[model samples]
Target: MSDDLQKELGVVRDEIDAIDAQLLELLNRRARCAQQVGEIKARHGEAGFIYRPEREAQVLRRIQGLNPGPLSNENVTWLFREVMSTCLSLEQPLSVAFLGPLGSFTGSAATKHFGHAARLLPQSSIDDVFREVEAGHAHYAVVPVENSTEGAVGRSMDLLFSTPLKICGEVVLRIHQNLMTREPSLDRVTKVYSHAQSLAQCHEWLNRNLPNVPRISVGSNSQAAELAMQEAGAAAIAGEAAAERFNVPILVANIEDEPNNTTRFVVLGRFDAGISGRDKTSLIMSAPNRTGSLHNLLLPLAEAGVSMTRLESRPARHTLWEYVFFVDIDGHRDEPKVAKALAELQQQAAYLKVLGSYPAAVY
Candidate 1:
């Protein structure tokens, strides 16, 4: 290389190294701040350790609102999520198990939520994540709850009945899927591989564009990408992470039929709530068989000025007619009005369980 080119290369390499050192220092400072926050939380209660969703959403909005945009909105949100993850680690090293054979969306979700600090355990089955948490091998577990396209993850809801673990926080990941393959041309593609949900979300696109191509379901979109990397005439529908991991080319990007497609995931753990000025609480209850029972249950919440975010009914285990309602409400259980409402609710419900309240997850 010429002397001028070599000088330019040396300057770039030195600049990169300097940036790395600065990043390391910034990360350490962030970790220390997190430790202090954890200590403050612990002095109040144990529940301080768990995450809360409302806080996280609020943080994300605030970050976007203040961003000057050398980095995009998404980039800022991701950076904060990583900071939160690292901060949480300083309090204690947590092991979180999620549905995965690695590189699955669940794995990505777990890592994104936990940051670079937590030990992640990948399990093949959703039930296995529950099992690992239940057996004390993991501090927490993450499982898919609902998808914008296909609806609830039935197995996760069913497992909720069988396990003692409580939902600690929720994560909603925007789904962006791409058609990727080694085959360079769309004409060369004869088969598709992806998770069932991915296929369902892209149903219209697949039928309209590649009607004759056979679709095969796999455990995850990442797994499909792996298969595509090894097979000719095959393509996978998955996220950008999978594409980078598998080194496969994205033949068609954002193939998911719905632009607003998203998947909601829930965190399961034993920790209770630490007071976050803003928070939400989840409750499971069953009302009496008679008519005014459901109304009676909701009236107190309305009177308390609590907004109900989610309400879904599951068949009460071993009971033909009874149904349990899983509710997500906007306020901490410890709040004066919420406590009063729960007290009133206890009188009207056949069964009531107060799931743990934690510091709302913050971005």
Candidate 2:
């Protein structure tokens, strides 16, 4: 190596070392500040307010907006997320529950939003996750509400109607389903197993590639991977995390029908999130059984100039042939325009329930 080149490399290494030292010092200083904030909250009898979703959302959004990058905005935000997660844990380590055997997309969503510093509990079913939070065993619960490719998660939607929990936050995860198996060759596979939604998402790919193989719908993709690990001729359609966790070999990657398949998960907690600048309000309403009742219910929102993002109908469990409509609007419920629309709609509807207003997912 040339002497000049060696000298330049040494100089760059020293600069990097100095930067690392500075970063370590700053991080420790920040953690100390976080600890002091916790102490102040305790003194004011507001310790439970340490994890504020609105404040965190504002912080992340501001960081992304101000980022001038060699590193992408996402990379910067992710680093800060972990830093904040660590600082929050210093206040109180959060217990989060998600639908899982582990390695499910719901579990991934929980980790993505809460960070690895949180204590994640895996529940067998969506209902179990809600129960865990409701029973005070968990601080929050994460469950998949909808998928871009396959549409709504019916069980999760139904649970939302009954559970007293509020929607405190949302996370959108890009899903990449893979075909994995224990066998060395795909030619030897005779059966496929996966969650019903996953199987549906990869339906076209499965039909085209494994034409003769029978597909089975299981409870979750993680459970499907578990079965594939134990069986010779079985393949599972799941995310890369499941394959890695279960020690299965990937036979095919990106097997879903859509390249941009994404799932939206909601965080359920005891208290509703305060308004973040960019927010979404979700609610359920059942119109009176009359000719123009549904039309009347929606007319106020449109007249009030509030944009409705989504609407889904679920069967009301107590009343036969009666359906309740779940709606997502573009603003927080406390906003004057939104509040006016909701008030008018309440007068026209037979039932109304404001689920919660929460910050929209940041990409």
Candidate 3:
């Protein structure tokens, strides 16, 4: 090798080593601060759910805004998330529950919001995920409330209405659906396995490329990937986590009909999240059995100058005639305008429940 080239490489290596040492020391110092926080909280007799969702949201947003790096804001946020997660472990191990077999998008959401340092409890169903947190077996539950491609996840919404758990945070993951199989090409494939939502996301692709192949809906894409890993002439449509977890090789990548497919997942816990500047409050309300009841119910928000972001109707389980309306609004419930809207809404609606008010997804 050229001596000049070796000398140049050595100089860069020396700089890298020095930076690494500095980072290690800073990380340890942050960890010590975190431990001290936990200790101080304990001394004050206020230690509970040591993980703070609102504070974390504020920090992430601030760091992202301040980032002026060669690395993208996403990369910077991810690095800081991991660093914070590691430091939090020095205080207390955060526990999170999610819909699983461990490779589902829900699991990815949980890890994304809570970071990898949290103990993950994989539940078989969304109901199980909620029950785990409600029963105090887990610190928090993460579940997919909606997908951009497939619309609402009916089960999650239903559970959210009934569960005592509150929505404390949210994670938005950009989805990439891959067709993975052991087969060299699609020619030999006989069947495709995926969650129903994934199948719908890739519906056009499947129709064009594998029309004759039977598509089977499963409990999750992770389960689909597992089956594909062991079966002959089989392929699974799943996210990268499932593909990696089940050790399936991707033959075709990002086959979703919509190129910008994304899923929004919510964090559910016993406690509420404080107001972050940018926040969303979810609610379930019912209109009276009158001609203009629906419009009347929403009038409060308009009068208060509060913006309503989403409104969906579900069949009220208690009555045949009444419909339950799930609403998402722009501000936190505690904010003055939002609070005034709710105050007015309380008088008009037959029923009202504030599901949660949490910071909006960072990205």
Off by over 4 Å in 3: 148-152, 187-196, 206-235, 244-248, 319-321
Reference-based lDDT, each prediction: 0.80, 0.88, 0.88
lDDT of 1 by residue, 1-363 (tens): 999999999999999999999989998997787677677777889544545444555667688789998999878888887777667666777799998757766777787677777899999888899999999999899888775422337778778766788777766777788999999888899899988988988999999999999999888777899999999999998888789898999999988898888777888897654555667787888887777778888888999888888898887776444888887788878789888998988887887787756444443
Q: What is the lDDT of residue 357 in candidate 1?
A: 62
Off by over 4 Å in 2: 1-8, 39-45, 147-152, 183-191, 211-219, 230-233, 319-321
Off by over 4 Å in 1: 1-66, 87-91, 148-152, 180-200, 207-250, 289-296, 358-363
What local lDDT does model 2 show for residue 204? 94
| Model 2 lDDT tens row, 97-207 | 998857767888898898889999999878899999999999999998886433337888888888899999999999999999988887899999998889988889988
Score every model by TM-score: 0.74, 0.88, 0.88
List the candidate numbers ranked by TM-score, top first: 3, 2, 1
> Residue 249's C-alpha lDDT in candidate 3?
97
lDDT of candidate 1 at residue 265, scale 0 to 100: 80
Better of 1 and 3 by lDDT: 3
Lowest lDDT 10-mer window, candidate 1? 46-55
The clash count of every prediction, one per candidate, is: 5, 0, 0
